[model samples]
Target: MDPKEFGEFVTAWCPGCGNFAILKTLKAALAGLDIPPHKLLMVSGIGQAAKTPHYLRCNGFNGLHGRSLPPAQGAKLANGELTVVAVSGDGCSYGEGGNHFLAAMRRNVDITLLAHDNQIYGLTKGQASPTTMQGQVTKAQPLGAPSNPFNPVAVAIAMKVGFVARGFAGDTELLLDLMQQAISHKGFSLVDILQPCVSFNKVNTYAWYKERVYRLGEDHDPRDWSAAMAKAMEFGDRIPTGVLYREEKPDFAARFPYLAHGPLGKQPVDRDALREVMETFA
Candidate 1:
């Protein structure tokens, strides 16, 4: 399959937005895996990053603000055959949807989360997001942000999320590989992608990330929790990108007794059983 087979629609993003590279890389990754558009399900919440699903020629669901993961999990549970991806911005994933994000890792659902970490809330203009550095001045905080930055990679690794990785939008080849690996992983996966909000954020531009971001060396072990935690904490001058941690474990659907037979969507409904339960309530 060709990347162009996924097709594309006119996007509302800024011309130089990092999302454009991410979108292109995602298409290439899916094409590389030979996943047809029909087999993939893209879920997103309200934000500039949430607009990703709208541009893809695949099954998509645009849910409420910060509610992308729940529906993505649900879709995966119902039809295990679908390749589910939940896309969100830093604000949507780490601020408004913080609780859901925690729950998703705990559940270990068979889905991949693509977090567009632009560090600023672009959809609402230049506002400091959860990942925004402490004391960073934004339109929302002229006096500078009061709180410390949230480290999502660290949090995910600490939670022992099945797969934890980071990607940079400026590097398409690396991003594509990370995307494919995250998707193919047996359990829940996170690819926290560093992106530049061209119209909103000025500090962390393509050039800035290019200088700081570096791939993990072959000596680094992704399965070692301690090593992964250390790598996750490395930020500022030299940021480490690539698979930080991974562990083999049973996914949420795998543990369910009913799913042992088949996925819920593929199973035939037992009308008699349903009628008996309803009659008892009646």
Candidate 2:
């Protein structure tokens, strides 16, 4: 997958949007992994971030709002050989799709979820999203968010996801590395990208993140769940980036004997094939 071959169209995102950086990082990651566009399937829920698949030259499913994971899981179940990646905005992933997010981790699905956590709903105008800081003011929450911002990394680490990490959209190099690692992992992998919504989010801007975000220490052990959770919890004063936790586990496909034949999608499908199965029932 050459980086040049990934994008088939120009992006529609606002100039200086963090999504631009993420898009570049993803292309580089896929290219580094040598996974061709035909072998990849990008599933996305409705949002500015969801448009990522449209820009890339790959099989893409523009799923309903907050519904990227279900199709991603179904696609993977049918064709476990496909490199499945789910992308969504903070509101789409953390707010409307929060339940699916949890279910994926619990099911240990073999897929990579790249969450664009920009702290605001960029696509729907300026609104406070699930990851928005409590004090942040938005059009929908003029007074303030009131509730604490959801902690995706902490939740993933506590649930024992196969791979959990965080990345900064500003740091393309580090994000590319994290995206590759997540895609390479066998089971559920979540990379919560700290994205800055230039137009919608005035707070938590690039400079704000730059001042707070730092790479995880080399001594930091990803296998240590306790240490990982602690790292995930660190924010405000300092934010840790990189793989927080990772451990191998039986992926959804491996747990099912029926999927041993490889992706069912690759098998022949026709009225004759369907009728043969119906005749067997008789």
Candidate 3:
């Protein structure tokens, strides 16, 4: 898990992209966890974020646009032992993939989701994404974005997701720590990364984030849902970046007793049972 071993997935993104920092920090976190590369499965959908799997030296799935979550959940349900991570962009997750995001949170599947929140569509040449700030102009929104931006952390907190966190790409160490924590969490974990799209997004730049971002103090309690919601609402003056909330709730696997022992993918299907069912159908 050395930097050299995990640096292969570097060429897909644009130069000076914030995703590079995320990739680096993620690799560092994996190294710290001592998880074997082969045991890690990275899944992604169509977007710059989806390209992460290609860059990293691990098992990967490059899926359809806005469809990474379903398969990632399936992978986890099939084999809970493997470390499953899904990478997606704001446009992919909040736009076309919005329904799936809501469902995934509700089901409480055990998987780590690293969402690249750049506010603009980079791969499609600078369009307004769901997280794009109001009045922010892009190729798609020539007159500036009219609607309000989507707050992913707020959504996750409201949905009562097991682990909700936010990280800035600039702070590699802190991002790495957050990633590790998210991966270890039992249920659905969403890490909305405030990544600056160097080429397409100009408003939410590194300096803009640096001026506003502040870390939540050590005294804060991640288990407090109300407090976490309040913190999630903070945006203008001091943008809070850290683990917003975490509660050990019953996961999807726990509800379905059959999958409690392990994911279905690793288990051998009963051919006799299938034959009996087929015979009944016939």
Best by the lDDT measure: 1
lDDT of 2 by residue, 47-114 (tens): 99999999999899999889999999999888887899999998899889999999998998799999
Candidate 3 stretches with Cα past 4 Å from truth are 279-282
The TM-score of predicted model 1 comes to 0.98
Alpha carbon deviation, residue 65, candidate 2 (Å): 1.1
Can you write out model 3's per-residue Cα lDDT over 1-282, one digit (the tens) per residue?
476666564376888899989988888898888878888999999899778898888899999999999999999888888899999999998889899999999999889899999888889989999999899988778899999888888999999999999999988878988999999899999999999999999998999899998888898898999999999988776888999999998889899998865668767889999999999988
- Determine which window of 10 residues in candidate 2 has minimal summed lDDT: 260-269
Candidate 1, position 23, lDDT: 95
Q: Over the full model, what C-alpha lDDT does candidate 1 score relative to the true structure? A: 0.95
Instruction: For model 2, name the residue pairs that clash.
Output: none
Judging by lDDT, tell me the better candidate of 2 and 3. 2
Clashing residue pair totals per candidate (backbone < 3 A): 0, 0, 4
Ranking by lDDT: 1, 2, 3
Error of 2 at 40 (Å): 0.6
Instruction: For residue 44, give model 3's deviation from the true position in Å.
Output: 0.3
Clashing pairs in 1: none
Task: Predict model 2's lDDT versus the native.
Answer: 0.92
